[model samples]
Target: MLTDVRKTDRLNLMDQRGLRTSTWNVLTPNAPASKNLLSEELRKNKVSITGLTETRLTGCGEERIGNSDSLLWSGGSTRRNGVDLALNSLARKALLLHEAVSDRLMKARFGHKHGKMTVIVCYAPTSNSGDVTKEDFYSALSRCLATVLPP
Candidate 1:
């Protein structure tokens, strides 16, 4: 018997050395109190980097959160389907490049000894979403993936 492995399957099992990464749907972390709480949770879990969805933070920008932790966020003009990438002090130092692709997609590049690693944070459309919305997300994701440097 033969098994077929997809790209996502490979990504799920890829080794990241000692890097600790995670994803979370935070509902709405628009308030300072909520952001502080989220920072605490990340610290308690020992997560070096995290991808946040539904942040509900309008516009694109970067901010300092809880000492040295950095928060880079991208959102639509109206604050819907936002995405963000948070990195601790250590991980922030290795960041090479990052871009706010859209409200639903964000891309970051990190430097390693061997090569660069691309981390794409995306909030994909749900099954109930319209076809056009889903298609746009995938299309944008494809373009982002195509631009990643070889590792």
Candidate 2:
């Protein structure tokens, strides 16, 4: 298993123990089988939290996986760029707030021993994307970061 999983480029903070997080750009997990496989992987790896990109899940909602793990997802009308967060039992208890900022971005706040930490998961437009699209994503991300609570 990889050591650390924080999207540091988006936001950097001190690390905490026992919170094994990771990020994956899953093409899509709309199918039940795919979701099941994903869940199985989570357990097998013992991931405390995972950031999912390109989920393509319409709308925003939470899903309970088995009796402990949970999935928080966000997306748009069409089956396109989406992101989500999968929290195991340990991370679930630390979860305080979450939001579906847009199809390309999602945010979650966890209450850790050091107070709180905000995690932003995003799927940025590729270099081939239009300048406007790239600008929009960065702007939205900036706004999201601006709203973080003071330490």
lDDT of candidate 1 over 9-115, digit per residue (tens) = 11211246466899999987877687777778888898888999998888888888887788989999997899998888766767766888999999887765556
lDDT of 1: 0.80
Candidate 1: residue pairs that collide? none
**Model 2 alpha-carbon drift over 4 Å, by segment:** 1-17
- Please give me the total number of clashing residue pairs in predicted model 1: 0
